[model samples]
Target: MILAALAALNVALAGPWPALAGSEDVVVEGAWARASVGTSRPGAAYMTLRNTGNEAVTLTGIMTPIAMMPEIHRSTTNDKGVSTMAPAGEITIAPGESVAMAPGGLHAMLMRLQEPMNEGESFPLTLTFSGGGKVIIEVPILKLGARGPEG
Candidate 1:
């Protein structure tokens, strides 16, 4: 009876366990967007995503009212020494880790923009987690030549 009581005490102290068993904690911070003026059909937005949840979260999609389509993208340097960008299917953020959407890395691609993205403007941005929860952020238009966060 004493052993059973001790076990019960331990379980209560630990509270309800995570549904996923052993999930780690991660968070997102310092999320912002970069402004762009381009003749192309699409423009890019940059930000940093920090994972502060108890489980790894995958960035599956984004919601933006300003653009027709918002997709995850990454920059890749080709053999010719030119940097090319493409769509990113998903991004995984480990517990206590972060994913940066900066220049020459992963970013958000806003396609079919209704209007030109100007500096000093704000837009609605919604990031969806794979598990279910979504984070809604207001992304301000940053300077076109501004550099993203370092580390």
Candidate 2:
């Protein structure tokens, strides 16, 4: 009885299980999207991806039902103090490492939004990896001008 109680507690504390059994090498957390302004067709999503396995994984693609087109992007500022956003073809995460997608850096770009993403709403984002692994995560929409998910 004690063992059973401990097992239950472990599972409960672990939260939701991975999508695929024995495929919990990669985990995503703290996913969020910035609230959209009126008539804005593009938005960005941010998350932290961690790889706990002994192998590296490459994030290749992203898809979302709320957007007509989804792509990975990286924001950079040049020497002239000009900020530009460009497509990030792919991102790799080494074993036992974590990658953060935050503002002014790497993010998932949602183009041609089907509808305005309002605060307190959530949407699904499907991420595909190079090794045929895929994970569907629900990203929450935060207030406009929010810097991070903490808000």
TM values, all candidates:
0.74, 0.82
Write down the RMSD of all candidates, one decimal each. Answer: 10.4, 7.7
- Residues 48-92, candidate 1: write the lDDT tens digits: 787776677777789898888888988899899999877889788
lDDT for model 1, on a 0 to 1 scale? 0.73
Model 2, 46-142: lDDT tens digits are 9999988888788889999999899999999999999999999988888899999999999999999988999999999999887556778999999
Model 2 TM-score?
A: 0.82
Model 2 scores what on Cα lDDT?
A: 0.87
lDDT of model 1, residue 106: 86
Q: After best superposition, candidate 1 residue 22: deviation in angstroms?
A: 13
Clashing pairs in 1: 24-54, 25-53, 25-54, 26-51, 26-52, 26-53, 27-50, 27-51, 27-52, 28-50
Range of the 10 consecutive residues with the lowest summed lDDT in candidate 1:
17-26
lDDT of each: 0.73, 0.87
Error of 2 at 11 (Å): 24
